[model samples]
Target: MGERAQQIPFYCDGSYLCEPCAELCRTKVQRQKPVKTKAYKFNYQCQCKFMRGGCKLRYQGEEGVVLSEEERSKQKEDYKKYLNEKLLMMAAREVPLNRLNQQQFEFSLESNLENAMLYDDEITRAVALSCIPPEIVDLASNPVQQLKELVNWFKFEFFSWCDKPPCPSCKSDQAVERVGSDTPNAEDREYHASQVEKYLCKNCKTTVRFPRYNHPMKLFETRTGRCGEWANAFTCLCIALGHDARKVLDWTDHVWTEVYLAQWERWVHIDACEPLFDKPLTYEKGWGKELTYCIAFSSKEMVDVSKRYVVDPVLNRMRRDRVNEKWLADTLQQRREALWSMQGDSQAQFLRKRYQIEQGHLDAGSAHKFPSEPFQPRQSGAQ
Candidate 1:
């Protein structure tokens, strides 16, 4: 004869389900009784197949009556408790942006030569810092405020250059070329070169390069340049001020700057290249996001001992030639790695695509396009 089946207790522990014989004597009991009048309510009462003397182990919650209000309330309370604990943990672990900025600022301050030409005097530092538009300064304090400052700075400082300036040679207002945009196009390059060659500076009667590409030209050489030159000079000035500033190469290879602000604890993007009359240049396609110029740095020993011998090779090279793909690719890769490791999602994606193009797996012509400029840095020009 078959052995008799043993009955199992419904509630065991404080919750439910016994341990020793619970697995073998599993069963389900419905709370509501079946109603034949209503089809949906029919067979409301059900039991687990195991309890029905069947080998199969099956249980259904919906087949039974709805949970009681007390049970529902208890479950909701449990969930709320879990969520509150999680929020508290997150709040406690959060790192303030100000802390990060302070750390970076301290780092920069400690890692420089005592008498580097960039910091020859305190006055130069003050001037350079002042030149930093409020937007760049506020990036560390408030990103939204920085963005507002950037828009206004670009509009008033750089964009206003689109207005025709009196020709340096003729002094005739009519000679001003109303270049709609400050972005150097192929035509602009030709015009700029032509103007430099033809127009003599009245103050010195010296022929000047129209679109200055180097510090000497924009600062001490001709003492004047177009918007593009001004943008580059401004970026260099920021870098000289001990700020981690760079010229960003965006769509059309337009120039801009990224400033490491101490208060905001982040690098804030700024465009000082917009011509006075033109709309701010926005990235449309290709050319990645921004390409930064690589500055050659010598060791302290070399900088000190060979300061005179270490001619301004990089500067001279940058003035006449466009940067090559190999150098750009390597520099971009370094920047990407640094950014990605820091959890910069958007910047990482942009760099990855640019890296693929630089490696020749993708054609930049099809994948990237930039504004026309004749004065790109050339590898051959490197001293």
Candidate 2:
């Protein structure tokens, strides 16, 4: 009414004004721009903020029932039992094969010694003198260094990843009738259990036998295999070269090799498939695997080597605990001992040493207390 053109509705915040003044105030409010001040530095001044605003230091989730010390002890024991059993089973399958291969390995070495550069001192020395660069040879001052060199050379030599060796007769790239003989032949006599894939050459009326030999010697001659054969054969070569190595198996369905580095006092992972040496994170970090168990089996012993791959043990071990810990442990222990004895070729001295070392490994729970450098997985499409 007084000095106003129109009547304004009553405001929420009771400031009395006419329609024009109210409209003007609304326009001014609407036109006002937001203050372009720096973002507020929040220290989570509220409990709700702390709980819901994603504070790193805050408990990640609702706290579960606190485990008793006794319960925790029991769990650890059970976990040990379960995990060891799996380890032993892996050992059972691999150790026998290793033994069978080992039995024939020495024979193979002897036959090839004259031609094998490393085994034959004459040829080896000659190569060292004339072939290998002096600088490179000089770098191999230790066994590990020599191993790296051998591994690099091996990568070049056995680069072929042939599943079925091409028919030698007609050089045909075709599959023939794969025949499995119940018994062994003259050439396949030693590798009796080895599945002989008899391919009928489409080109020629010839039967080509690809004896999928588990023997490293056979692998050496053929120079190609799947992950298992590669790991198995490579480990044997590491052994032959006198570098203590093991066949590393993953419960997540993978296989690789690990050579015991005496100088570092640790087992270094080496995958001939990825051709990655000392890249333990190649699986978890690179492959993005949610792995539970990674067991290492040599002729002498087995160890739960999960720490080599997984950074967060607490997360992974939760899954491992899903199985019955007690029964698993007992059965695993029983089987391991039985299988260790079953090998029949393990040296008494080595067995004794291995036993002592394995006991030490068991006692020292949670391997990688110090842990290795934070593993950054290589960014690649290939896992």
Give the Å shift of residue 75 in candidate 1.
Answer: 46
Tens digits of per-residue lDDT for model 1, 1-383: 02122222233222222111233332334233222222121211123232323212222223444657786676557645654454444333323335454454334222321112233235555665566665487565564454455446644553334223456566654534433223444654432332322333455443322342333122322324444444555554555445555443322234445554556443344545431111112322112122222221211110101111112222222221233434433543454465455546775575455434433512222212323233223211100
What are the Cα lDDT values of the candidates? 0.36, 0.51
The alpha-carbon deviation from the true structure for residue 168 of candidate 1, after best TM-score superposition, in angstroms, is 3.9
Residue 64 lDDT in model 1? 44
**Which tens-of-lDDT digit does each residue in 1-383 have in candidate 2?**
23221122333232333222232222222223222223322221222221222222221222354567786677557655654555454333311224444445334322322112222234323432343344445654577677677666655664355555577776755645545443447677563224566666666767676665555555555666566566656666666555667777776667778887767755677776656777776676666676866766654455557756775555455445323444334534553565467457656455556556645653464234544345556322221
After superposition, the stretches of candidate 1 with alpha carbons farther than 4 Å from their true spots are 1-124, 130-140, 143-147, 157-165, 176-197, 200-213, 216-227, 236-243, 250-252, 260-268, 275-281, 285-383
> What CA RMSD would candidate 2 show?
20.8
